[model samples]
Target: MTPNAASPLPPPAERRRLRESGSLTQDQLAKRLGIPSRTVNAWESGRTTPRGRKRKSYAALLAELSRSAAKVTVSLEKRPAAPEPAPAAAPLTPAQTFDALYAFCAPALVRQAYLLCGQRELARESVERAFQLAWQRWPEVAVDRDPAGWVRASAYEYALSPWHRFRPSHRHPEPPPPDADDRALMDVLLKLPPPYRRTLLLYDGVGLDLPETAAETEASTPATAGRLLHARETIARRLPELADPSVLHRRLAELASVERLNAPRPPAVRTGGERRSRFWTRAAIAFTVALIGTTTFTLRTAPTHYEAPVPAGVQVQGVPPRVALGPLSEAETQLRTKLRQAAAHGPERLLPVFR
Candidate 1:
């Protein structure tokens, strides 16, 4: 036999037509397409169809398969090229990052604050206030190891602040029903020192490891580890259910929903439009106060007394052209007498100038 006898034949659309007429399976199409059976199946079933560069290869294979059959031939053409993929979006800006981060952390911070303060609205307010501060300090925080932890710490501080703690809420949201177990655990955690609370929450709650936890709290690994160990042991003794992460998660989730743990929050201090508004408000108020003071002073200190010109006509003997004092002298007894008579007779009884 010649070497050419062993050579494989070309595939063509005629092979596909014959196969379809014969009701042959995708396995036969696979032989024709020179592809795996699954890919042929995908093509035939319309799950996917080849195009672009791959279509050229498919057409060549089909042509080769057609030549071997001899009974038919069909024109081969490649499919059009596939559309290009769209470009990816740009990365988030620093301000955008802060906003996203605040949104992600608000609910958690609120739950933590609630645990500490036992007031839902106060806790929410604390978290909102904390995010407001974090937004202002985003430059310092966005790069720092644990921005979320920093925000939570700030929230805790705000929750415990004397002013915030004592202030009454005139318009408070309805108090949510308490989860007894969560409140008990939170009670224990809240009683822990700030260092322990920071360490434990970063580790057990935020899922941070020792080094990251240490960085967040500005403590050494050993110190953070120690605090975490102590905190865990304390919590475990009080609430053994925390030993299982699942239980802890369920409890936390319940708290989170109520607190809106994941809600977007504002920055701590005024920035952007808020900053401009505060500045202009203070400036306007200052200007108004200054204008009022200036007006009052001008009205108060200005000389009130003035002389009308002596009416033309009637005679004046001697009386050395009367001087026009801006106001009457206090020491002149006659002036007092003239003031009293003027008051009694509505100025008609007072002696007049020559005219």
Candidate 2:
């Protein structure tokens, strides 16, 4: 890789731009990354930065863009979401809600993945992939009621997704033999349905008490207790070797630690003028695609909303508008009250805003 002549330490603005536009253009990437374009713009303008695992997510976008630049078949398209405002409000989509919740519970999820997969790369990838899927279909996700529970549920689903069962060859050419202990554990864990696996992992692997587990899983206390009892019995019956909960926890933790050590490094940076040029090149390509796609789509179907309806307003296309909330209708106030009551002591309690 030719190093850019830009400063070795990217300026705050540049790093922000790279992080927000790490994949491509701000708008295009916002669409692909399942975030609002304004959020992307905020990051690029150095108003905010992605935190924790979100940093890795931005890295993942860069990795994807790098791959797309090299591959001919790769294409980026905006996934559709509910129509609504120029700038979306908090809780833009179900996926965004999931993203926030997943970040909060990442520590436990990482630990669970470590135990189940026995390797750091597999565990982290599993988490990231699960979040990506949740982001893709946030609209239908039950997260409106319980975001953390939704993420925990989604994580297990991702772990058991058919694509995950067979390791991607580019990374694991000669995958471990099926009879390996880790492999055996993975097979057993994969057999459990999402609800059971989630309950079992949170209770046994993460060591959350039934009440805590219920809150995290969005299940009632009784339901959580029942699932835990049933999951333990089911595991013992199906995987007799794993009847020892101690052995199961130990193996899972071992796998997780192995994965932690081998985590993939994020991409490199260009310096000075080179950095600017690189940014422009990435932006140009994304712009070209956006222009073509928008033009073609618009010609095919005239947009209900005009690009620049107001004067002196700079309008951008290809980004979805935010959900609009008009003056609170009477029904809106009643629903808001119920929502506030339900969310009063739930995941929002663990979140920074609510805290």
Candidate 3:
């Protein structure tokens, strides 16, 4: 193809037509290209152009589309003209789109998250948080180049966050014990670095193809493949029995089985009601804090009357002239007032007292 004959990037309409001719949706094309559906949409909407590697992928996809179209044209020329195709169905609303994606993708995501974190509850939490984020940004996520990949990446990140380590983890129901070899493999897997482990899980455990794995991991295809190979080699070095591809595949299958058996059920989809409930719960907490703060400020500022102790044998004449213990020394009075304030407020508010 002449350089000028094929533009560096095809026009938006041509891209959209190519995808439609292939009977591929934006999400489908994104998955094939290891990109997000939103990227596909942006390219087709003339909002952005693919660059570098993506530009090359785009050109190749267009070429493939052209070849396929030519084949269809030749086949049609050999046969009678067909009836006109029907109009496409209307696009789904955001709610419908999210619900469809959730139903289709949540279970697999939970399993993937489980493999990453090794805790059933944490996996579920990660997937739920990811979906919640997706729901909040549905407009963008829905149009994403690979919606499932977008959510899966989010879930993976959530599972890896240091914060989850501090959260309590619920015990998962134990699966049937693994055989000796499986046990050994599990031990080795746990020792792998998180990136290698996650790549191995996505490619082998979850059965994602290299491109899909790359998209989920936010790595290029070559990078993801390298990680997978490194993980396998690492396993092989540690477990000589797995050096054989057949043995390694068997070990991977066993590991995948363990993940499937132990995977937590996907959490319920987040709804507006839950968000509202959370908002009210936060509001109640804020109100309680404000009330406590106001009460403490009032108490600290309230006047306190201090009575001086009379010394033994120090009686005065007629009415025992009231002896105000020489007004407490300036420093002592301030210290006493600060102590009261500290008691009324929290110790954290006692800078003056410490000074």
TM-score of each: 0.44, 0.35, 0.51
Candidate 1 residues 87-121, lDDT tens each?
98999987678767866776567776665565666
1 versus 3: better TM-score goes to: 3
- Residue 183, candidate 1: Cα error in Å is 3.5
Model 3 segments more than 4 A misplaced: 1-88, 162-168, 171-177, 203-230, 244-254, 257-267, 272-281, 284-355
Q: Which residue segments of model 2 deviate by more than 4 Å? A: 1-111, 114-122, 127-174, 177-180, 239-241, 258-261, 264-355
Model 2 Cα lDDT, one tens digit per residue, 9-59: 234465454544434665577667666555555555555666555556665
For 1-355, candidate 3 gives per-residue lDDT tens digits of 2333344756789889988999998869988998756567778887677776778888899889979998998988887567678799998777777778888888767766766666667777777878888887878997788898888888889887767555445443434235776667767876788888888877666556677778777899899989989998998898887776545655665555565523232334556435855898999999999999999999999878876887679646689665777768999999998877764456566354553
Per-model RMSD to reference? 23.1, 38.9, 20.9
Query: Which 10 consecutive residues of model 2 have the lowest summed lDDT?
Result: 263-272
Write down the lDDT that model 1 would get: 0.64
Give lDDT: candidate 2, residue 132.
52
Order by TM-score, highest first: 3, 1, 2
Best by lDDT: 3
Please rank every candidate by lDDT, starting with the best.
3, 1, 2
What lDDT would each prediction earn against the true structure?
Answer: 0.64, 0.60, 0.74
